[model samples]
Target: MMGTKLQVAVIGGGAAGLCAARHLLSRGDRFAPPVVYEVSDSVGGTWIYTDSVGTDRHGLPVHSSMYRNLRTNLPKEVMAFPGFPFGPHLPSFIHHSDVRRYLEEYAQHYGIGEHIKLFTEYPLPISSSSTRSRSRTLKEEDQKSYHPEEVAIKSFTYIIIRNRHYSDPYIPNVPGMEYFQGQVMHSHEYRTPESFTGKRVVLLGAGPSGIDIALELSQVAQEVILSHSRPPIASPLPGNVIQAPGVDRLSEASVLFQDGTERRADAFILCTGYNYSFPFLAEEVGLKVEGGVVSPLYKYVVHTRFTSLCFIGLCKAVCPFPHFNCQVLFSLAVLDGSCPLPPERELNAATAEELRARLESGFPARHFHKLDSLQWDYNNELAQLGRFEPLSPILKELYENCKAIRGRDLINYKSYNYKISSGSSREWSLLCPQ
Candidate 1:
């Protein structure tokens, strides 16, 4: 086993999965080229917008949650992968289709497309409910599930799994929902604003999707009501939009708010975001999905209890491409025995301690994987451990500035262009979008 090239199984062909495969292919001596299992017929997982929602042609739940008019909220400068620029000509906030093309190009350029097995279903977790407390021993059946009839059963020490983190959109069940129902749907089902024309819409979340969807609906809807538990947004909403307190309940032909206010609406759109569901991985692996967070993962990549398994691209509110790059390289270093992890007991303790601290700080368990502003620190930690160059400081500065721009003007933020020059000075600028 030590003499032969290490075999790795990458579960998805999304951005994170592509990063893992690209890095593995680059290091042919230490690792074998990864076998990437993509459920879709192509790369670029969530970036690919499918007009078909609910279930796809294969009867699998539709993986993409992207809307028609969606452009990246983050600028291209921070979103580009390290060592691969998006080039100087493209606008900072490009459309999602452009992102899919860029990923396809990235795969083609690196010869990763040849190794990718598209239109394959993810293998069910080897461990079933019977083995509730212990990791499942991978048998010949598991290996066959990975490559189907093509690749033979081979002994591989490491398995790299990618979790896209954007499946199973969530909509909280409000009481009395059955009483007043016009059209109830989640943002994942949303394709265009045309269906909502001239209607009174109630959006039940103020996250990025809610804000973006409300803005899109404002153009076509007669009136849009944004109901949320949080305090009002700092930025002013459009004139046609109304901010309401959290929903208390609903009645026939009316909606009740916590403030005792009532409004009647034609449709209900839940932008409440998604849940963390890894249907492929069983519970015996010492991982738990309570609320929206997957737990007991050291560094949010490796399974602390099962060292051979690692998950990529699970963190939320991150600079995804660059974040995936760092996570992938660090994971490879761990697999190659270049970067040593802590003992199993220490790993479990560290994971628990991190969650304890976060909970003590008043953050919900659902946000355990949200990196948000803390992603810069997480990236540096990985780079230092993996012995790779850390991301430039300018990226963090520019990222924060982008958040500020969004807060100041959600509608006009995408209109600005951004650039981050290379070298020590690392000049950053924001110009008008072309």
Candidate 2:
């Protein structure tokens, strides 16, 4: 209510941070212009950081650079911003570059680029010796190691953005792999079908990427063998299902099957995805991973102990991340007193654990959160804090559409489902995931 300006620090200039900044600005009288710290020179986070290793049909960079066949899993309707609707000429499921362009346009349209301080890395703040000194002034002995930047100040509120890049491919130690005289590369390094032309390729993992890569290679490679310990759940999309005979392990440039069959390969593509790594908070933050499951916070946003700092864009179950980011911004605004703070106990431990367990149980254990369930939880908390509003008719209609096609309870929606559906089916499923 006072005229004093509130200083808010957003650590990451990616989609989540930009959204939060916009939300804070929207609350005209609540806070000052937010400070956004971006380590990269450009606006696109991972998209800008990763190099183009692949190309599209028009010779444009794919993935971030050149990722051919890389399409957004979400529908354009739900994925697009509220005001600046997606162009009608674009496909329902557009390529990744389109998404990047949209992000750039959103940033420019909202004037968020001005607030972002690019190329600034955020290290943990150091403790000040002055705060610990018994005397008002410290002697030269205490001043020897003291630095002004080391001091922790309480002037600004901080929010951390978290995301895992698909670059780090998981390569399990396989016997005789080192002896193999063939080319071996992780999915991150993979760019185009030209690299595997006329080569016998052994593709690993059964996830979406693996399946897609194998399908691509099958066209150019002399023969493509998909090696997996267990059968992959076929993507729900309609297509010719290719199942390579099961293989037990890789050995001497060849795949050895459980039943004693073997086939040589000229190249091996590891389509295994990334592991969740938080080098910044792995030690200082008490994150616990038991039986390959990690749960570091309540509702995957707020730390149970350190409530001042929150994590945005960490949910694996969500798609069209802007939706979840908006919810997070709303929550953050409530915390900042620009709006009302949600009740502390709306997201119960039991529910959070159940959600966590279900996500971590898949073959590749990708996390997925249901849109309606998350919105419900978010709205309930907002209601307790007196900041709740019913979903707009458009959002409500989208939610019902998503629920009807999935046939699963809205409380249990997951991201993997999006990967399975065809363009048309996916278009029909347009709810915002948490």
Candidate 3:
């Protein structure tokens, strides 16, 4: 606050944004009070938007939206912030509502809530010609002509946001979807189950949401049809939960499959996920999306050429909140001159194509930008930034012992299992009556 501090903007007020902001403050480096722009009136991005108390479009109530008695997938020990451990009475897996509350608590504990600018949307700004040029050279007269405002603007940078909540649902073109549907709606519009009580329902896709709805309506609806292009993996756990083999495909829904084997239904709930897109940035920004996958950028951290601007929570197959927060802190350290940026190369056409091929190879042709396991990813990121040394043998043994205990299931709540040994305090309950 004393000198001219660098200006930074953080987009989105979800867990990722809060984590980034907290790290920025922790660094206590010379920087302007970082501005956090949240487009919603409240903080919780996806938690608030999701159907927490009502029915879904398929007439499945709020209770059906979530897995029956589901708990947090991650244990409390790893899920919580660095200093704030989950206290006693920790459940193996907490409820979604409890998770939302914990997010709010994290924001409050770190004093980040006060810094956030709610109800603000960020539309990407046009890049000025002077700012884009690669040449750093300036003429004698040009140097004298520079104004204070121009210099400050040049130094300022931004952090872009991408998440499931931002994406608009993708509903593919089916031949007679318009003709025979009694009631049709995308998952975005779905709210409750009162409407489908006695009606036959056909829920499309076999992802977590689709499976949840199918199981909820099976008993109430005359018949519940789960239509999928490929059979789900269906991993059977202690409870009657089935983990889908992989992500679902939207294009697989063809007229033939619908007519040949699919059951007729009173309504169709398309649980198909969203597409990879950013409405704000222009195509020339060099953020490439090939075959539904964004081009690989520097160990999935900072953009190769654009060091000032960073992205968080873009990786798939990992929990974005805590993992991304840890990654963002490392990135911030580099940006603040506390650490050095990792060595990386500019993405070329071939690299982009390779990423595209890798994304398509997954079970369902969807682009969530998959990565490896959480712990390994976190460790690699820390190493890339040169932030942490290898754990000592004693510490490593202790950590492994903790992970083993956390992995055990103590309570079988259907899709929600509580890993008692995980010692997660953030995992709480969101109990909805049947």
Q: Write the per-residue lDDT of candidate 1 for residues 61-171, one digit (tens) a residue.
A: 688988898888898888988878786789899988989988998998899998886656565553422121111222334432323333333344666777766778876
Candidate with best lDDT: 1
Candidate 1, lDDT over the whole model: 0.82
Top-TM-score candidate index: 1
Question: Ranking under lDDT, best-scoring first?
Answer: 1, 2, 3
Report the lDDT of model 2 for residue 377.
Answer: 49
Per-residue lDDT over 1-434 for candidate 2, one digit per residue giving the tens place of the 0 to 100 score: 54575556666666677777777677557677776765445576544434445433323223232246566544565566555666766755567678778778878888888887654544344111111211111122332322122322334544545443343345677667787778988777666788778888887776546766776677677787776766544435223223455556677678776668888888877766665555435354565444334554555566544455566665543444545455665556545665533444544464466664666764333433333436544544534443545333344445445546444331233332222133533333333445
Worst lDDT run of 10 residues, candidate 2, spans 126-135
> How do the residues 119-167 of candidate 3 rate in per-residue lDDT, one tens digit apiece?
4444344232113211121222333332211111232454535343334
TM-score of each: 0.92, 0.70, 0.70
Model 1 clashing-pair count: 0
lDDT of 2 at 418: 29
Native-structure RMSD, model 1: 4.6
